[model samples]
Target: MPQTPLLSVVVAVYNGELFLAKFFACLEAQAIEGMEVIMVNDGSTDGSMAIIDAWRDRFPGMLVIEQENQGVSVARNTGLAVATGQYLSFPDIDDDFKPGMYRRLLDLALASNLDVVTCNGNYVYENNRKPSRPIFPEDKLQSTGVMSGPAWLKKALDSRKFLHVTWLNLYRHDFIREHGFKFEPGLRHQDIPWTTEVLLAAQRVQYTNERFYDYYIHSASVSHKPDTDDTLIRSARHYIKILEMLEAINQRYPEQVKNIPACNWQIAKEGLGILHTFNNMKDPQKKKMIVKEFFDRGIWRLIWKNARGFRLRWRLGRRYLKLKKATRVPG
Candidate 1:
């Protein structure tokens, strides 16, 4: 019989002192046997590193690797390099897992012999728990959707239903390593490409309608912070690059062309959504500047494409143009 799994759970952290204890406690409570919890402290200045150090002594199998201030992707990649698990999972230090999350997810992943095994997660903030919002076209679970890597990705992308989330799944170690894949070191939205890439290689897949992850809405998360940073622009560039790469992949897998529409539509809408959320920005100058800076060649084309289909989009395009005019950026 195979030796018990040394499942490596990598928790990526950077100044996550506020939630470190709860996160580790959640790890401790996981009923999965023979697991190693690898914590990556990505140059946290806060008490986060100290907290992890304390736990290093407390948790017998815990390993801590310290690095300079790098992004979450680098930290995760570092963990991946040293991980000895038969299976791999990524967890954010600010998130928690339901009881037996590892056990249930691992069982499904191994049983299916899949490159990837995904599960649904519940969104929890404060005291509220809600179903994980689907990132795919339709929110329906195929009563355990399973597919070949290409087939599954094509369907999900066409349906606009792929969640593109990193934490909601488990992956085979060899598959990840053999593919020469790692989280993008500095890209803010690294998961989009990483998940899409791996699903392209998945031979078999599995899912359970279980909400075993507690995805917390915390301000400390880089994604939740103010968007007026290099991180946003950098991540946007990364996203665009991924799209270009996928276009090349589509040449090889002609059936996945439908993913193009879903990607472009969401990119256009979500770009606008980001601006909408910034209605709370207090400084008009900053807001105007941000709006002006956010637009690019592709975004302008997306706005134009979407505008033709919806009057609301046309109005937005007009507003966007006026902002660009006011900001006096060359068209």
Candidate 2:
């Protein structure tokens, strides 16, 4: 009889041949045992599959799934569908796991019986060869403790220090499955909304200040790409999708999301920023049409309605008026 693995590491890659060797070496150096790594090749035209196969030869039991070129969300969902471990972590091919990272996370998760256990990660720049910025300040996580999902979210939102990326947290598989948690397909910025839903559903969460993951920042990465009109438009559309996902979750668990109004405000603010980018578009007619799509959708009104307090309402109103004035176009 096969014993269930303690943790599953899911890596979703697209044209990741350049990073596979370093990433595989990082995985090999892990002090943790009883873990399985699942690699999903999302129709890479490069030699990524061959790289994965060579590693599979060296490391037995490494699962590889080949699929058509879907987006990152779809790739992640495919990996989740086949994950057999009690705990799960999603690592990007470009990122490297620090020494003992999973061992520490698994140990904390087991000791606390937590729904989620999260640690800090550092952003390593390709150009800068020095230490990177820590996700959370040292004073903020001076001690380790447990908090209800909702409580932790409130504190995290207030400070704006929450690690919204998927890889930073190790989730209990049963908890995620039971809650019906899955990333929304065909969307960028899926992690922001997915983490929002996960935090609201989590009952017990453990946190530590120790940095365990290396987030590589390079020009080629989607996040670090130049913000051209196309990129801004894509980000704007995705933020709208995320806003919708968050609204559904807020309605499902209103009590768990007392700070949702603040979240809504932040999303709306991003939408406004996206709208402003249209001003930089070369085609004036196209810019006007896209601006109308944002305003005609009544996203601003919905955000104002979501604000729960007088202060929040007043703040959002001021921001809204400013955005409207700055980006006005003839109706």
Candidate 3:
């Protein structure tokens, strides 16, 4: 058995052969000391397993867990169960981490004794070097500072850029372990709820302006394609659950949580988008089932309850009209 590592980077691999080499190259170049890579293979049927095997040969200490096609959430939880590190982070297989990112983040976290250390990331599009908007808005976090959990939560809720992502932060393993922070299994929108809960539980959170991670945006990603029935329904259901989570957090820490209405409005817009996707589907059976599901679960009622903004209300009204037309059975 090898000595313990300072940080454990958990990766969920599923048919990621195309980008495995690049990701491994970046990982091999990290200057961090005593770091271990814990990768969970979610039953990748492609050459992903082969690539992982090659890397395992090269790095004898790398921990790899194999499981049937459960989901990314289960893969991550599987990793968390056995990770033997002081700190933890989860990076996607397709993204790039700038050299020394782990080292820098670790330095910050250790120096400040923070529960979490977060940095900025660049959203790299295939055709463009720069995104239209910055991932971390200039005004959101003015400088390197330490903030209370409540302060961070309020700011994160106000600005879309404030909460960069789960992967952009370094979390103490003990902090997560104490709170029992596990990603919601079988849900694609696991990051939002899990991150929100972690921040709520954290006492001190540190932020830095260094852009150390690259988030590659592709057309094939789930967030970019919600047209299909399964994707649309899953995303909509997750959004409702996320809203409920935020509401619960707000109630638990009423004085700390601000802009609940704004957060609700943003999530409600996505809910409307899901309904629109269902409305545009051509398959009548799946469409009818989804429509029935939406009504049966009172999704529309929850959406209407939170549609406060004028633009959101307008969009919700339009989507509801289309849903009504789509749900009407021919006599």
Count of backbone clashes, every candidate in sequence = 6, 0, 0
Put down candidate 3 lDDT per residue, 157-237, tens digits, no spaces: 666555526789889999899888898888777787777668777898987778888888876565775467666656666
- Give the per-residue lDDT of model 2 (tens digit) for 109-190: 9988999988887888898866788877776644359888777776666665556788889999999999878888898878
Q: How accurate is candidate 3 locally (lDDT)?
A: 0.77
Please give the lDDT score at residue 280 for candidate 2.
59
How well is each residue in 262-320 modelled by candidate 1, as lDDT tens digits?
A: 54454555555554544545555655565565565355555455332565576576666
CA displacement after TM-score superposition, residue 163 of candidate 1 (Å) = 3.3
Once fitted onto the true fold, the runs of candidate 3 whose alpha carbons sit more than 4 angstroms away are 1-4, 57-60, 127-133, 139-141, 162-164, 219-226, 244-255, 258-263, 283-285, 309-311, 314-321
Give the TM-score ranking, best first.
2, 3, 1
- Global fold similarity of model 1 (TM-score): 0.77
What's the distance in Å from true for residue 202, model 1? Answer: 1.7
Best TM-score goes to which candidate? 2
Per-residue lDDT of 208 in model 3: 79
lDDT (Cα atoms) of all candidates against the true structure = 0.69, 0.78, 0.77
lDDT of 1 at 34: 67
Model 2 superposed RMSD (Cα): 2.5
Candidate 2 has its poorest 10 consecutive residues by lDDT at 322-331
lDDT (Cα, 0-100) at 2 in candidate 2 = 88
